[model samples]
Target: MNSRFDPSPAAVPPRGQLLLVSICLALYLLFCLQQIVLPFRFFGMTLSLGSVTMLGCMLAISAGSLVRHGVPSELVRPLLAILMCIAALSASVLASNHIGLACAFAVRYATSLLALWAMLSLAAACPRWPRAATLAALIAVWFNLALAGAVWFQWPGALRVALAFHPEETFKYLPRISGMYEHPALLATSAAMVLLLVLRLQQRGEVGRISLALALVGAVLALALTQVRNTLLPVGVLMAWWAWPRSCTSNRQRHIARVALGGIAVLAVFVLWLRYPDMTSAAQENMMTAFTLGRTYLWSGALDAWREHPWFGLGAGVFQFMVPDYTGGRFHRGELHAHNLLLAALSETGLFGLLAGLALIFALWRPLLRIAAERQWAIAWLILVLGLSTFDFYFPFFPFSMHAALAVASLHAGHCAPSQADGVSRSTT
Candidate 1:
């Protein structure tokens, strides 16, 4: 078959473009590792070298796209949506008790949104970008595993140096190995995301059998070590969703089997709960207190704040300070933002902000649907995002959220213009 007509060959992208994209991805990976690996700050500023690199990459991609394509038409609606979300969230700052802190957080949120927009635009322009992105994510999975091994083996030099730069509280008491992230949950969520990506890549023949096996094992290990139930549950659901159809011989059988399995699982859980009511209650209580009442107290505080200011709610960054007040003085911790994404939006920005967020998600949904027929994994990624967001904040501005945006863009854009995947035209630049 002619290389141009071969979908597999066309999807690999040109060597030159791949190299450039890989360099950018490498820098982005460094940004992910800045906390524990290369903690070099740019000048005397608080911004790390990785942050500067990421900023530079975003600026360069934006500038090049403007010169070549003059702002993609596909980006118009998403950009408008982003602007509305930012405006809505920023407006809540007016109602904030600590105006200064709220304003700072608002600014940070706005910046992250714009950065996300730029990344999506870049991905839409280059269809093969997701290939590089998957490889990058795999590398991150391995890097984290290496770090975990370092900690477990007590490699004096490596462990000592990495821990020296880590936050004291993160490792001072808790023995959980966070690896490259500041928190174990963060690491677990990221690993879970990568696991899905690796599986998809393998399905598409973009990854080898050996590589896929290693990545899945590493990602699973990371999740187990982190012990984050919130992430583990979602990953389990996604894995089941991914494997169900493959396990059946036909669509009808697949549907029937899925329904049967789901019913059985639910019934079993119900039976267990009924049989061991006290045990179930004790387990729930223990999980809640695992991390000083875990997310229950934080969620309670968020709901209380939202009820107090239902319309506009408390201002951005206000939840941390008002935790004690909202939680009936039970939570005295400082700087504790809402752990749940929906609650964060409702409590900090209120109805208007929540609506704007929905609008943004709706805007992105179009392209995602457009690619769904060819790239089902994109929908799986979306499911993971929403599922994880219910327990932890993964919307609008987390690093993982930004990466998700990039991955989705790559999938949508690649399907939209398969002809350009081989870098046949300068327009892709």
Candidate 2:
């Protein structure tokens, strides 16, 4: 019920080309797993395998796509803005208190921003979007293996995540979750997005019921492990979408099913509320705590950083660097992120970066709305993503939305003809 229901991008190059896609996927998975499973820490610096893999994939994929088709100007603007923002952040760090540490993170930030855009430009106009989408789903499942393993390990990942986070009092406790993501918020957001894909598979009545069931159970467990309250909003959106009553009278109703998922959700919330009265406040403080407090604190910190360097506050990777200064000389404090995607640019790269991001988001809206109006299964997919982004960074969330962009491109390119996903011409031969 949520995403733009466009299947225009559901193309496959050819069975022969799947091999190329698979090799790329294998490399990406290795990076995600290495970052989490083996988390490297040395010389008081962390060089995560995940970020490396992420950046590497972005670069490789962007190159592959550009080689296939020249880079479009529409894509280049935002990408350059982000890069410039990173550069500014790096420069600001040199002026900061710790040149060494800021430099380290600056490198990391530079890598992430580049990798993100590369993937975006590369996939934005590719063909056979569904084939690419299918590949993405598999990768998501691979990443989610961590959540499954944690569930099997009998570890209360949910609790571990809560305790790990500052401004303490989170009490979410779910055992054996998280395939590899170290942070609960990251885990929750990713799980939510993957779950939407599984739901898409399940809706298709294709070869996805059993697999989707497994993915859903694992995703829920992982979300619990994250103990992230933000999961509620995205999950809530899904529930509402599911609950919207089916207008049996409307011709479009048969095209989609609006189950009373929200009612079920309300019932569940009521049950949880009932438990609160019988238990200590600590028993469920995770749910009791204000959900947006941490995000608010980080955003507030970002604002302070902006004020100091109104032009380009801090540096791209300088959020943490700027925190102490913003705190009025307090040392060793909590970290900060723009939290909201657009604001991240505003605070980190000043108005320049922020405008670029907004332009991209605006660019996406037209196509997104067109797809949404189509009311296809994919539309449901996008809605869930929308919910997921509220809590986590989804803007240029890459792998998650790459296929979506391709689908939009396919629609406009006639890739999704009434006849085929490949936009091929029929041959009697």
Best by TM-score: 1
Considering every candidate listed, which one attains the maximal lDDT? 1
> Which portions of model 2 miss their true places by more than 4 Å?
1-25, 33-46, 72-110, 120-126, 129-176, 198-215, 238-260, 263-295, 321-339, 370-429
> TM-scores, in order shown?
0.77, 0.64
**How high is the lDDT of residue 298 in model 2?**
60
Among all windows of 10 consecutive residues in model 2, the one with the lowest summed lDDT is 420-429
lDDT of each: 0.64, 0.49
Error of 2 at 223 (Å): 2.8
Question: What's the TM for model 1?
Answer: 0.77
Error of 2 at 355 (Å): 1.7
Task: Please list the residue runs of candidate 1 whose C-alpha ends up more than 4 Å from where it truly belongs after superposition.
Answer: 1-22, 33-49, 160-166, 243-293, 371-375, 395-398, 415-429
Model 2 agreement with the true structure over 328-399: per-residue lDDT tens digits: 544344344556654565566666556554555455444444554334444555566556655555433334
